[model samples]
Target: MTSETALPTPASPLDLGETLTFERDGAIGILTLDRAAKRNALDDATITRLGEFFAAVPEGIRAVVLTTAGEHFCAGLDLSEMTDRDAVSGLHHSRRWHATMNAIAESAIPVIAVLQGAVIGGGLELASAAHLRVAEDSAYFALPEGKRGLFVGGGASVRVPRLIGLTRVQDMMLTGRSFDAVDAETIGLVNYRVPAGAGTAKARELAAAIASNSEVTNYAITQALPRIVESGRDEGYMMESLMAAVAQSSTEAKALMRDFLDGTGPKVRK
Candidate 1:
C-alpha cells in the first residue's frame, strides 16, 4: 500500500489550528501528534484536533496507527491550561479527554500505538487505549501526576491499571519511577519492543497483517476479547463459544477452510 494517501486536514469551525496530522496508508489510518516543539504535549487545541481526526476517520480505513513526529511521543497534557480550574470545570476538562481517547479505543477499526522517547502522564493514557502497543528502544514510560500535585485526568486510572498492576502504576506516580521499553514490555504495558526508529514501520506491518483478516473475524476479535476478559469464566466461556460459532459459520471462514483443505492456502512456514 502506498504511504502517501491524502487524508482530510483538521478543519473545525472553532479553528483551534492543526496540532495533529492525519494521513492514510492504504487501509491504515495514521494519526500523528505534531506538537514537537512542546514534546507533543497535548493542549486544548491538540486535543480538539485529536477528537476531530478520530471522529471523522474515513470509512474505508481498516486499522489505525497512532504515533508522533518528534523525539518524544508525548510528554503529557499541557499543564499551562490547567491553572485556576475549579472542580466542575476540572471534571468537564477531564471528561473531554475521556471522550477523545474513547473515540480512538472504540473506533470501528483497531488501533496500534507506536511509541518512542518519553511517553508520560496523559501520553501513556493515550497509548493504553490502543489495542496493541509497539515501543522503540528509546521509549520510556512514566506517571508524574503525583509530582505535579494532580491526579490522572485521563483514563489512565482505569486503562493503565489493566496493563500494569495497580501497584506498579502507583509506584510510578508516587516515586516518579520510569520504565524503559523492555521493562514496559515485561510489565505488559507494551506488546513489542524494537530498535529505535523502527516503531512506526513495525506498527504498520502489524496493522497490515491484521487488515488481511476477514472483516467479521477482526471485528469480533477487537470487540469481544476485552469483554470476555472482564467477564466471569462461565459467562466468558458462553460468550466465547457464541462468538466462535458465529465466526466459523461465516462465508469467509468456510472459504478459508476449503482453501486449506484443497491445498490452495499458503503452507505454514517458520
Candidate 2:
C-alpha cells in the first residue's frame, strides 16, 4: 500500500464541481469521475482527488461503486500532461499513478466499476483494478499505446495482464484492437455485461449484495482469493482449507449455518 498523509480532520461531504464526486448511499460509497468535458480524462488533480477520497473513505461505507458521469467511463490518463522528462521523474510520475490506483484496488471495502462507452487507454487500466466490473452494451476496451509510440504507465502492464492475459493485452496494444462489451465479457475482461445505460445499476446491485456479506468474509475474499489462485495446488488447497475453517468459526458464519440447518434460511434449490 502506498503511504498516505493523515487527514487533519474528518472530511466534509465532497462538493462535486467538475473533477470528481464522492457520495455515500446506504452502505455504498459512490465515486463518480465528473470531468465529462475531457471524457473524464485523468489529470493530476483528478488523480490526487481520487487518492484522497479512497484513502479517507467516510465511516460506515462497506463497498464502493466507481463510475463516470459522462458518455465515456474514462479515456485514460490525460496525455496533455506528458512532457519531456528525465527517467527519475518519469518513474516517480508512474509511481504516483500506481499509488492512487493501488489505494482504490486495495481498499478495505471492495470496489465495483461501471463501464460504458470508450473504456480505453488508462481508463481500461482503472477499470481493471476494481474487484468486479460491469460493462454496458456500448462499452469498448482498447489499449492504443502502440500506435501512439507510447506505453502504458498506469499499472496496466501488471493489472490488465492478470485479468485478460498477457497475449491479449499485447494484441490490443499492437493492433489497437477494441473489444465490445459482449466480447469483453466472453474473454473474461468484464464480469457482467448489461444493456446500454444499465452498468451503474448493475454495479450498485452487486455492491449492495456484496455489502450484505460478513465483513470478515468479504475481506478474506478480496484480499486472499487472488493470492490463493496464484499459488501452487498444495498451497492453494491449504489456503482454502484454512480460510474455510476460519470463516466457519466466525459467530456470524455459525449463526447463518445454524439457521440453514434449522430450515429457516434460503435453501440451495435450483
Candidate 3:
C-alpha cells in the first residue's frame, strides 16, 4: 500500500465538489455522499461525479467503501431535479444513469456500501450497484417509483433483481413495500448487517480484508465470477477454467501459494 504522500495521481481530476467527498485510508478509497439536506439524494451532478470517481480511481487503491453523511444513506433521486421530457429525452436520461451504475458495478476493485436509514427508489438502485453491502440495523429499503407512477430509471430492474430475485423486486416495485435490514439480508440484498452506528466500521473491516487479497485473484473474483455465472454452463465452465489458469499464473499468486506451502501464509479462520 502506498502512503498518502506517495499516492499516484488520479487518472482524472476528482473535483466532485461538496456533494461527494473522496479520501483514502491506506489502500481503501472512501466515498461519502454528503447531501444530507436532501437525504443524500442523487442529482445529475452527483451521479456524474460518481461515474468520474470510479472511472479514474487512483492507482493502488484495492477497494472502496461508499457511505453517506447523516442518518440516511440515501432517500433516492432529488425529486426537484425531475423535469418533463419526451420519450427520446427520457430514454437518454435513463441511459446516463445506467452508465453510472454500470461503472460502479463493473469497477475493477470491489465496492462496499454502508447502508443506513432510508434506501429508497434510486437509493436502492445505487446500493444494488455495489459489489457488497453492509446494512445498518436502521436501514430500510424500498422502490417507491412505482407508487409515483414511474418505473426505475437506474439499473435496478436488472441489478436489483439479480441480487434478490425478480419476484422480490417485482413485489417491492408493485406494492411500494419496504424491507428492513434483516429481511434484506435474508433475501441476499446485503452481504452484512450491523448496529446502526457500526456500519462504516464493519464496511472498513471488509474493505481491508478485500484489500489484502492478491490483485489477480481479486480481479477474477470481481470481474470473471459474475460473467461466468451469467454464461451458459459449458461457457461458464470454460471461462472459469481460463480465469483459474490466468489467476494462478500471476507472480503474486505463486508467491502466496509458496507461502502457504511453507507455513508462512495466513490460514482461514472463523
What would the per-residue lDDT of candidate 2 be over residues 220-256, giving only the tens digit for each residue?
7987788798899999999989988888888878877
- Tens-digit lDDT track of model 3 for 9-117: 3356577766988889999999999999889999988887887788677788999999999999999988877767778767766777887787788889899999999
Poorest stretch of ten by lDDT in candidate 3:
1-10
Candidate 1 deviates by what RMSD? 5.9
Using lDDT as the measure, the top candidate is 3
lDDT of each: 0.84, 0.84, 0.88
TM-score of each: 0.89, 0.90, 0.94
What does candidate 1 score on TM? 0.89
Q: How many clashes would you count in candidate 2?
A: 1
Clashes of each: 0, 1, 0
| Stretch of 10 with least lDDT, candidate 1 | 1-10
Write the residue-wise lDDT of candidate 1 on 1-270 in tens digits: 112212225564223366766778789878777889989899976776676666667767888899898899999999888898999888877887887787677666889999999999999998998899999999999999999898998899999988888999889989999999989999899999999999999999999988766677887887888889999999999999999999999998888888889999657789
